[model samples]
Target: MTITLLGVVGSPSPGGRSFAAARALLDGAAAAGATADVLELADRPDPEAIQRAIEDADGIVFATPTYRARSSSLVKGVLENTGRGVAGDTRAPLLGKATAIVHTGATAHHFLAVDDLRDVLGGFFAAQVLSPGLYFEGADYVDADGIPTLTDRARELAEAHGRAFAEFTAAVRAAPAVRALRPLL
Candidate 1:
């Protein structure tokens, strides 16, 4: 199955660490045979446009720069607005799609944001969130080349998540779609 992976980078400013991380992660997804694209939300985003992108994607890589102690408010707004739109349209727009979270923070403590996101995406969006979300603390700064080169460990983890996410999305695509939350027969 050919899968399209969409990376949405949510940074309050352009060229932030998380923006670069998202770009790097998209490269990893493309390397793993996914058709990858990205939407960097630095400008004023239209809610309808965000909803359309989320609806059309086969898989999503949600990357954000941590703010205070959480993912960027910009990212949260996108999710909240898109989630509300899709839920009203149908119970789950991402019923079988996969989503992976990547965050860049000031310290390892920022990694906690991934768990918060996983719950929101899985419980609210009905996304099959891939395991072992990625986080890079402080190291990756976007250079003049606009590349977000990750540390050895972070690079390995990002590539692994990409490969795993692609495989999982393909698997889910092949399976039958579930129409409702019926009890197991």
Candidate 2:
């Protein structure tokens, strides 16, 4: 099955690290035979369009830069708005869908930002949260233009994560037995 992956970049800065990492992850997914699309939160997002994208996607990758030890407001806004639709339903629209997160910061101390995202995604939306969210620190991979360039190891990890998420999404969509057990609320 062809999996649709949505990469949401929440950084307010254009071409920031989080956005670049998201693109890299998407590229990896594309190489694995999955269809991937990008949505920039700073581009004046439309709630309807965001909802449509989320509903259509089989997997989602949320990427953001650490700001005050939390995710960017833009990213939070998009997720909060989307969560409203699935609030009380046993089977949320995002439930059973594979999801991953990526965060970037200037220091290793900012690793907690991923946990902040996890708390929101896992607590509110019921998304299948993947472990070990990719966290990049320092400027080793960042370019003068503020884009991220993954090293060989980083690329390998990103590709593995993408492939895993894609496979999980496919299996979840294909197995009726699994689907029957999923909580709809």
Candidate 3:
């Protein structure tokens, strides 16, 4: 079956590390026979549209830049506006769907930002968040026309993660039990 993976980029900048990583992941997912696309919060997309995309997607990749040792305000704001409750009847649309969290930072000191996002997406929303979420440091970038972009290694890693996530999501979606689990909420 064809699965759809959506990348939600929370970077305020149009084409930063987070965006590049997300694009690479989506590219990998597409190569793996899944449909993929990225939506940017920097464009000020409508909340309802974002929610709809989340609900329609089989899996989601949340990409954000670390700010103040945590996810960007854009990411938090989207979560806050999207849904509420913790695995309750009114749980977020992400419940039971596969998810991966990707964050970029100036250094590795803020890696725990992934944990914070994981707690909310997995613990709160009850999504099947992929483990060992990705983190990109400044050193992982390379100079591209005087602008920083993801190094080949970082892009490869992100793409591999995306392929695995897409395959896992497809398997989860194919199982009747997994699909039923959502309605049990």
lDDT (CA) for every model shown? 0.73, 0.76, 0.85
Candidate 3, superposed: residue stretches over 4 Å from native? 84-91, 179-185
Query: What TM-score should be assigned to candidate 2?
Result: 0.85
User: Where does model 2 exceed 4 Å of error?
Assistant: 84-92, 144-146, 175-185
lDDT of 3: 0.85
- After TM-score superposition, the amount by which residue 91's alpha carbon in candidate 1 deviates from its true location, in angstroms, is 7.2
**How far in Å is the alpha carbon of 122 misplaced in model 3?**
0.6
Candidate 3 least-lDDT 10 residues: 176-185
TM-score of 1: 0.84
lDDT for each residue of candidate 3 in 7-67, tens digit (9 for 90 to 100) = 9999998788899888888888888999988999999999989999999999999999999
- How many residue pairs clash in each candidate at the backbone level? 0, 5, 0
The sequence of per-residue lDDT tens digits that candidate 2 reaches over residues 50-154 is 878888898889999888888888888887666524436432556556678998888888888898788677666656677878887764373645456766676
**Tens digits of per-residue lDDT for model 1, 41-133:** 887667787777777778888999877768788888886665322424542455556788998888887778888888787777667788778
lDDT of 1: 0.73
What's the alpha carbon RMSD for model 2? 2.8
Residue pair clashes in candidate 1: none
Error of 3 at 184 (Å): 13
